[model samples]
Target chain A: MQIIIVVLLSILTILIIGLLLWKWRVRRQFRKEEQKRRLRELELTAIRSQMNPHFLFNSLNSVQNLVQQNKGREAHLYLSDFAGLIRKVLNNSEKEEVSLAEELELIRQYLNLEKLRFDFEFEVLVDETIDAHNTQVPSLLLQPFVENAIVHGLQNKRGEKHLKIDVMKKDAFVLITITDNGIGRKAAKEIQQQKNGKGTKLMKERLNILQQKQGEKYKLTTTDLEEGTLVEIVLPEEK
Target chain B: MQIKSIIVDDEKHGRENLAGLLESHCPEVILVGLANSVKSAIQLIKNEKPQLVFLDIEMPGENGFQLLEHFADINFEVIFVTAYDNYAIKAIRFSAADYILKPINFNELKTAVEKVTKRIQKKEENRQIRELNRNILQPDNPRIGLPTNDRIEFVEVKKIVHCKGESNYTHIYLHEKKHLLVAKTLVEFEDLLKEYSFVRTHKSHLVNLKHVVAYSKTDGGTLELSNSDKIFISRRRKDEVLQMLKTSIA
Candidate 1:
């Protein structure tokens, strides 16, 4: 009986030791995978900074339109703002994360140039509850969604168009809601002569890649509102 | 083990009728206690900590919603019994709660009982598991692994606001205001999410009851969500919508 008891105790100790070793191996594998994912995200982030030539041509055409129409002063201001936004975008592509304030300012510059070209109304509302300085977001994350909101959601609408963006923190996630009171998805689809031509497919792919980086926590939901489209991006709160 | 439940109604007949129905019909519910007022009901609940409560909306001193306000972190399922007119019913439907009206039909009672049986037990277990601390970034709900097309996303059930049927595809809208167009049909999703707060608001639409903001009576009632999105409510489902609204509260 004494020999049997000692044998059983040794077996239990061996099982526990084996379990600990297995757990350590699994944890190391996970860490390695996480490192690999971060590297991939970094590479994608750099490649995404390449500006589309069509957008450049469109902006240039607008500038030419302004120059031909002899709106010299306005054209000059538009050119400078466009230049400033591109410079900022290029600079930001080198960083992993930027202050929320800096990111929003970049977005503002982009919107300003777009507004000068399109003459549309827009609003940016950072919630009072949020500490703008403390919150850090990955650069260029919000640009694609904002561009989609402007180009697809609001471009075709008649009368006064409004685009509103709200940034609020929910638990450990930063929820960014972009609302555009313009023609909705069904209407936009009806008018689309080209299939996913206007960077929407690219936007979707970028979002998917971003979602992969955050695993399941990252969520991007687009709901068709009563009069327009509401795109919500929930990203992990990284400071 | 059977789940402990309480019946709360001002009328003795009402309480007894519900208790009798449970005794005869619902084998899953172990009727532990009964109460007639919000005051006594609170005491009973505090002591018993029952998993389910069959509450009447029109109590003498305080209504059902007021009773709910007394407690934070309501850990039990509540199925309200109400004598409804038009406005109150609309409000109940707007909230996406579960309820059975006075002169409750046999079928409605049976279905409500079955629904409560399935959900309340799951709630208790889920609640206990949810209380455990998880990785900070992960939401505190069971992750649903959805494999659609090339990508397999493990999404939290709570984040899914609604799923709409578009021909052969299902468009799942999340809390983050993201729409995922999946190749699977709505029926497949409905089957997977049968245990959740999703309800068939329309044949083409299945909405999460928790995300429902209001029910607009205009154009024969429409469902408004928190995201300012609107969905149509079929005429046949007006009552079912009300019941769903009530069950959603827990």
Candidate 2:
């Protein structure tokens, strides 16, 4: 009986050791995988930043044309705005989060410069209920959508082309809506160059990464208005 | 031969501006007529049948796009005059239609006139207009106008099974045992085809989710397509590929 009890104790000790060893290996593997995943996300972010073509060159081209046409004052006015936008973009780097006000200012600068060149009318409306100062979002998140609205929706419009952007707070979410009375997605797809899809795809992945990090919902929807297009971006409201 | 052209814009200033630009810059383009409204423009187009029309969008009652729908046999090519509106440019781009931006620059105007003439010389009839009309009327699953070295080929977006990158070019493999070598990069196809159930499964390949038959996760992952072609999915895009495949099936 003594021998049998000793043998049983030995078996139990081995089993405990085995179980601990197994658990340790699993945790180590999981950590390694997590490290790899984080690295990949960082890599993706760099690629996205690189993929954004230089809109500055085109704006400068317009400015150059203005200067050549002897519209010195007009060129000067637009150049200041363009310079501000470039500075904001450079300043926007290295930060993970930015205030809604700062983001809007950047967008405003972009739109202003574009308006100077393209002559499209625009309005940026922030709802009175929400505090724009305290709200924080992923830096450069909304710019791509705005760019899409301009490139795909408003660029082809005739008459006095009007653009309306509304930022409001819904329950637990901040809603951003950009509307333009221009051609819709259907038309954009038809003349779609090869580079267009890849840009948006990268843009979507970036938004997904932000959503995953915040453990909140991120939704983007593009709807066609009768004469234009409306794009809505829903981001989680978190401190 | 001098190309007879007409200017159509509700704004009297728009018609006058384009007419003046053509007169000054593009000596080869003669402004034959000018109309302020679609109703008058339609009558004028029928009467004059000018080789080209500088069409303006967003008039009082009917827009510029509505003008094309009026005629069954549109003979003239349209050079769209637009502002900074995005949708119109995209649609115009999608239709492979031609247009110039607002505050039109002189160089762009000269280029447009030159390009229209060259295009006319290349083909007697403007097939691009018909193609554009078809694309506008049917928005989804469009025949994407791909301009190859020789001619423009409109391929249905869904029929494409997969695309493989060959350095600077892309090989578009169709379902019916056919392939097209396009001068564009795979990145370009990714931009256009991603909306049509295509995902970048590998660095060198963009596969249509609709074509995926099986996905094997073990041994660095492999997907079996409906075309009997097996593709490698990188570990980086594995999760996204799975999610897209799941959603596509559902």
Candidate 3:
């Protein structure tokens, strides 16, 4: 009887210790995952903080040019329009995610500002089936790519330039496409050697963090066209 | 270099204004074709195959930009002539494309044609037009064109650290310790940049407010910029500087 009790007690103690060790390992993993998430969030904010100054200064420069040319009335009008854009950027800067409609509005304002400096045509088309006002997306997610299309793809071409943005609903995902009729990626890469552009890398990092927080796989792909470049991003809809 | 050129404008007055200016000022530009609409312009362009074109942006039916769309490959250079399109003017400037505003000034027209003549002589690649279209399409990330003696350097406006006036020239100090001496006056830069977070802290100095890291009260006043340069603040401008700093805290 004594021998049986000793064996049972030993098994019980070993089982308790084993259970405790398993629980501790699980807790450590959870803490590590939590730390990783916080780090990603911090990185996102750092990237977001580096925005808007480029557009803001260029708009001011345009106003300055108008004033220099003695177009006082035009300068005033341009300044007022610029103020509207600034307000939109400031309002959206604080948001983690914004309605699809709001994001589009911001993009429209951005394109309008760019229209002041270049003679290019652009159109933003959102599917009629998707309710833009109700849908939510990560704030300013499309900006870097749009900027990329203009800077790398279009900036060095000698002829007509066109940019188009299409946002369509694909069942559980939203498909966003940015198409530009400028110099293709191959030519652009040759011209601006070693400068693959910083926007895409930052964008990928952002999307990765979003994926970790929400267990949906986001996708981004770029294709070089004969005349220009096409970039497509697939993101999950807000549930 | 003799530039074979065409004029595309819907208005007779607009056409006359540019034609007269070219006749009086730009001896190098030879007029080859004239078109009143985008369709006619495309036809004229296809037929003449001119080396240069003076395109007016606004017109009935189709506009000047649409004419370029018809061409898959653009071989000719374009000098945009417009009345008052704030956006279009900036686009032209950003692209570094030559342009003459309506009520064309004699000196301005001469300068535009002269630039075209130089480009033609050098046989430089038509990079400006591409940049212009790109800037127009992506205005949010547009680069400002700063003219230098040898070539035009396109720099991002946010990259500029400060401007210091030196008589007829302005010394532009950029981020990454890059410096450029431009043939523009400080007053012009000040007027152009005043609204864009730049403060004229001294008679000869214009500081980009974005680069300012700290302000000091000693030695009348001083501003420490992110590039680690200390700028002197004029005694007269102290109040204005303080006010500006307070407003920019956000």
lDDT tens per residue, model 2, A1-239: 99999999999999999999999999987865775476456544633553345676778888899999999657755776676565556545655555677778878988887776567889999988765644556676667777777776777766868788999988878899988887778887677754553555665776776555445678988788898888888877542
Q: Name the best candidate (by TM-score).
A: 2
Instruction: Count the clashes in each prediction.
Output: 15, 21, 5
lDDT of 3 by residue, B124-177 (tens): 866677666666567666676777788888887778899987755778999888
DockQ per model, Cα: 0.01, 0.03, 0.01
TM-score of chain A as modeled in candidate 1: 0.73
* Better candidate number, 2 or 3, judged by TM-score: 2
Residue A207, model 1: Cα distance from true site in angstroms: 7.1
Cα error of candidate 3 at position A227, Å = 75
TM-score of every candidate relative to the true structure: 0.40, 0.53, 0.47
Docking class of 3: incorrect
Chain B structural similarity as TM-score, candidate 1 = 0.52
Q: Please give, for every candidate in the order listed, the TM-score of chain B alone compared with the true chain B.
A: 0.52, 0.82, 0.84
The weakest ten consecutive residues by lDDT in model 3 chain A span A42-51
Candidate 3 stretches with Cα past 4 Å from truth are: A1-239, B58-74, B85-87
**Candidate 2 local lDDT, residue A207:** 72
